[model samples]
Target: MSRKTALLLLPGLAFLLVGFLAPAVAMLLAPPGESAGTVVSRFTEMLTDPYELRIIGRTVLLALIVTVVCVALGLPIAYLLARSTSRWGGVLLAIAIFPLLLSNVVRTFGWLVVLGANGAIGRALTASGLTDDPPQLLYTPLAIVLGLTQLFLPLAVISCYSAVAQIDPGLDDAARGLGAGRARTFWTVVFPLALPGVVVAATLVFAGSVTAYTTPYLLGGSSQRMLATQLFSYASVSVDWSAAAATALIMTILVFLVSGLSSLAARKAATS
Candidate 1:
């Protein structure tokens, strides 16, 4: 490459080296007095622990649930946003994306208030004779799912909306011209074309959900102990820096694996 091109890339390269790569290297190398082999052995032992395995399982399950729920809920809203020409489309898009602008702590706390025993939702349910007891909405798996879904819904909506908007309306029109119904055209043309976006959305949601700490920590109980929160507990509560580092490495690997698999599926779908 030319010197000018190399110069232009140098700033970004330096920033990544200092900001991202530096911290990752430090984390990997700075774990307590153990050698690399001992660190690997400790990690292996962690994997064999049933409690750790359960935490990993719950983390993966929660991430999958959040991804599925976000996609199912976001797809139609994205389609509407993509297809609408009304001035309100912009307004709706802004509303859909507004949550992403808020800090995750703020968003999770909002749900906490609403789902708490004396909160509006709980009161309304109790007043409406839905149940005799106020539901334990806070600090549950259900709460984690609800909070994470709300937190990640905007991502799915924006991804799907962008993909759907790129698709030519004429394609749908032509399918209709051939006597295909709305559902038929959408299933055959629109849905297939939008699969890339769906994959992107799912991948983003899964990654976010997997690494999410604040929401799960605030809204989840012992039963909902995800890997991120577990890492925090190790670092902060147990003061087990080595274990925390190992867990952090595992979480990073899992995120990359999930992203890589999603990318492969998207490419295959695009080609097929």
Candidate 2:
């Protein structure tokens, strides 16, 4: 490359080296007396362990649920944002994303208060004759899903909205002009174009949900043991650094796999 081109790339290269690559290398090389083979063996053993397998399954399941819920809740909001001409769209967007500005611990604690027995939801449920007792919503898998869906829905909505907004309104108008109904135009043209965004949002939600620690730890019980929480236990409680490293690697791989699969699906849909 030319000297000017090299100089232009230097800033990005320096940032990657100092901000990302350096820390990653340090993490990979930190532990002493640990061969690469030992790390691989520990990961294999974790796979073979039924409890570990259950944790992995639970983590994936929760992530899937969260992704689905985010998409379901976000699509309508995204559609509205994409269609809106009013300044209210910006206000809605701000409201949707407000939770992200808060610390994760604070957000989790907010949910804790809302879902606890004496909290608003519990009181409302009990008073409304839904149940004789305050529902045990806190420290349940449902609470975890509720909190995560709320937390991640903004990401999905923003992604989908960006994609939808990019689409030409004339396309939808032309479809309707050609006798295509609202539902037909949406499903045939709009949704197909938005598939890429949906895939992106799903991947984001899935990866975030899988690796999330604070929400699940705060809202879930023993039965909701996600892989991240288990990994934390291995590292902090058990002091099994090698195993923790292996688990971290596995989690990273899973995130990559999900992203790759989503990309492949999006490509196929785009082509078809």
Best by lDDT: 1
Candidate 2, residues 33-93, lDDT tens digits: the string is 5666777788899899998888888889889999999998887789878887887878877
16-92 per-residue lDDT for model 1 (tens digits):
99999987867754676645665577688888999888888889998999999999988888988998989898999
Q: Cα miss at 224, model 2 (Å)? A: 1.8
Name the Cα RMSD for model 2.
2.1
What lDDT score is found at residue 151 in candidate 2?
Answer: 78
Model 2 TM-score?
A: 0.91
Clashes of 2: 0
lDDT of 2: 0.86
Clashing pairs in 2: none
Return the TM-score for each candidate structure.
0.94, 0.91
Clash count for each candidate, listed in order shown: 0, 0
Task: TM-score for candidate 1, please give it.
Answer: 0.94
